[model samples]
Target: MQTVCRDAPGCPEPGPGYPDLGAVPLVALNVSVRRRLGLYLNPRAAVAADWAALAEALGYEYLEIRALEAQPDPSARLLDDWQGRGGATVGRLLELLRDLGRHDILAELRGRIEEDCKKYLQRQEQPVQVPAVDSSVVRTLEMSGITTRDDPYGNVPELFDAFICYCQKDLHFVQDMIKELEQTTFKLKLCVFDRDVLPGSCVWSITSELIERRCRKMVVVISDDYLQSNECDFQTKFALSLSPGARQKRLIPVKCKAMKNEFPSILRFITICDYTNPCTQKWFWIRLAKALLVP
Candidate 1:
């Protein structure tokens, strides 16, 4: 897994008088905290005057103000500033935390920030899993290093034909689907999270770019776990935003374990590929392959 510090570049390092958070696990600084901070900061609502007031009131240094201003999005810039703190950053952050009456959250954030700094200093290499592609055609394409430049359709060049959006709980089933798809006559290039995301790259950036702009299709593994996951929700919404209405067909929802009612209001109406049915499993993949335009 990519270290949290890399994802939040310039994260503050622990200085004198702060609680030592060296022992905190890297996983403890997960997406939830980032999401929470994003919601809390509401960067879009912060005006120029508010920033100037904050800087003057907090005595923020040039580096801090510059860092905060660099991010185009409010939430992202907030995260960057939060992570990018050092001695000065920590002091300012602490004051803000105290004013907000979020000491408990600050304590948790302190641990995560310290842990991230340590990981960045260590230059750790995140372990990456090689993607498992079942289709012989895709395997051959991978070996041959074929790319979207070779596409006969003259569409926007894509690194992969499809990006698979699924929860960790559905990995086994997804792997099985990949294997079955491999046997199909058509070549399917898929971007599975565990396998495709390069080590050290920001997970959110890579996922967003691929799912929303780069990939030709998005295959969502629909399940209870998927619906509940914040990251999955983001991926689904981002994909849906790009392809709405009948164009929503670009988003292929595979029913792995979710009930009809469990699906979000927007997704309930779409024709889902029900992989949950044993009798129709074969037919489902075949139909899915056809929908994906498998040769």
Candidate 2:
């Protein structure tokens, strides 16, 4: 039986002259066919160099070499040199790539990319064993591989440039808000406790840093319990520690629970944002976003 195939634009088709006994199954040939996938190098020369060992380790096979550089021949020679070196360097490079690849994508995209990378690696005859990953490794990989210049979230800047200062009592609430905010294109680098505190940092230092410099805005989750806690007091006080010349107002008092009296002395200057009213909460995020000046 003769099989008709879709030919490329302006490309001639193999006709009756083409030798085909039709004895072989088409699926068998298609099964081993390599896929054209994207592999980006930080310096870009990695592809042109045909660093197969490096490519193999990174689970890449072919490089769609770019035309910007004039000496493609020399680049090929470099790849030949690297390949013949027994690929110790390539192995190391692959290890680094595997460790670093996890962090470059958003939550949704990360898993798919990882699976694809593994499959590609397997096809290249250098199947990489999965390694146990920790948050630090993930963070390192993410920061290293991210293609965007400085912005962590690609084109979308965070919704709140300011730091979010809230008590542990409202962790769930803050987390929920963060989840909701992420669903939108409006991003916020909201600093909640537990999540933002670097593992090695001293507790008080982390507190001080988040309040003092890291955050562009301060959001105090107000409730009687939060006001009573020493930890909360220190955090709030540090947030209020900003000098007069700071670009945005230092405090945004979010009334998480209704109170008969006003907020404490330090928070009294800023207008209260009541979370009770949906409109107020919406307005609070809007104003907080505005204060952040996120583009």
Candidate 3:
């Protein structure tokens, strides 16, 4: 029946003689009611501006308008300019708030904004779908060993000692691993998807052949993202096919995250090097180098 300021320090109640607003939600309040009742709100223009800035910093611009709406004297021009920007985030928040019918506490709103942003980013970060290698193509590569024949470095029978199979999202971790391996005394040649594949070459052609024939061992960087990727799935299957009897020797699993429960059924039996643990990093490199049989 009465308007309450949820954002301010004291949760200030509306003054005497002010209209009751009759449980109408702030979002649905008409411009006339807002113009009359807005003065009683605790967060003045300055505080509202600070809230807007905080929301923008958290990557939720939608909260900016809602923040301004809490102010006693919000700038109409500023609200118009914010709406003009027209981001998906703003639209999403507006819809969510409208459906809820009331504003939440500022802290609760901040948490919600962060969670929504993270989910949105995760959706956008989905791995690029790499076309699956045809069964006929797999058989052809296996029978002819065309990967070796097509190799630019013909004389060197072993094109790469180890192939680093990973999701593109984990590239930063993979790059760091490559850098560390390079710095080591071991004479190990690593094959990475981005660096090893020749420019203008079809991605599937390079990846499939390299996993099937060229690389002696495949170091699969396991994570939730990796499990969901078609490319990683294809590469892992090919690597597993190469080592029928002894998979551990040919296919090494490196745990970039705790993925034992989510790992593929075929690979579950094998021991995984837990690189996710900071204390085990040195040991992880040693174990992986040994697995690759680095000289």
Candidate 4:
């Protein structure tokens, strides 16, 4: 939060007239929004030593995580703590939330905070410089199925660094994947089904097109939930079909956790990255990012 000024789509702070968003108080946010934010951070309880995704996303050090997750308002405490350390702002919080792939929450937080700022400015008779809602945020939420879709794919080609296929059960892990690959130095664009795919399209058709034409590589998150998903089966097999014998190095199977069942026989020919193994953890993101680099 005190690190960068990287503002994101959705979060509008320093208001139409207010400047210096780098230190907006948490009190500027609505109570309901603060409570909603706790829904994501409190229960996660990421301690400093774990190198947990939440900790990474928020850039928290030491066991300071518990101090941020304090009750009544964990999100508020987190923001206050970051601000107290200097350089905390609404824009920085938005950027961190984006890294966590919680743009849905970002949109809500942004709107409420803006509304509060607007009211305060109006009472002061301050000139309001209300810019239009960020179109990119709108378009993003639309494509992610959080808002109305006005032909999401028509304006842009679907080409991407990789398409991530995972069960909802593994969304947190996938979010971590996003934080590392898309947010960090890798800067890889990941087409997550839930976040990037347009809603209401025929799932099978869209999935097939993305696997075959849109993405350069396929990342299949393998776990019990994924194994039970019929849709994952189709996407997995379809990717394999396009790159038979693993000739293209196109399909990257990431085994994140232990499971009762054996790894799928078909994927046996290809080597899998074991994320649960401590030895490989150091090189996991590096290996995955390298595999995703376009040939």
Best by TM-score: 4
lDDT of 4 by residue, 117-203 (tens): 444333223223336856565443333331133244345555788989899999999999999999998899888888876567557
lDDT of each: 0.56, 0.44, 0.54, 0.64
* Residue 190 lDDT in candidate 1: 77
Per-residue alpha-carbon lDDT of candidate 2 for residues 174-208, written as tens digits (9 for 90 to 100): 77667755455666666656654435434565455
Error of 1 at 92 (Å): 35
Which stretches in model 3 have alpha-carbon errors above 4 Å? 1-158, 245-248, 259-261
Candidate 2 residue spans exceeding 4 A from truth: 1-160, 244-247, 260-262, 278-282
TM per prediction:
0.46, 0.41, 0.46, 0.49
What are the clashing pairs of model 4?
A: none
TM-score order, best first, reads: 4, 1, 3, 2
Best by lDDT: 4
Q: Given candidate 1, what's the lDDT at residue 149? A: 40
The alpha-carbon lDDT assigned to residue 52 of candidate 3 equals 45
* Candidate 1 structure quality by residue, lDDT tens digits, 1-295: 1222222323454455433333322222334454555454534344222333345455667777676666444443443333323232333444554454444445556565554435423322232335675454443333222233434332334466678888898899889877877645656767777865545545555566677656778888887777578677667755664655435468888888746434543454467889878888778878887776632
What's model 2's lDDT at 164?
A: 60
lDDT over C-alpha atoms for residue 29 of model 4: 42
RMSD per prediction, one decimal?
Answer: 14.0, 24.8, 19.8, 19.6
Alpha-carbon runs more than 4 Å astray in model 1: 1-158, 258-261
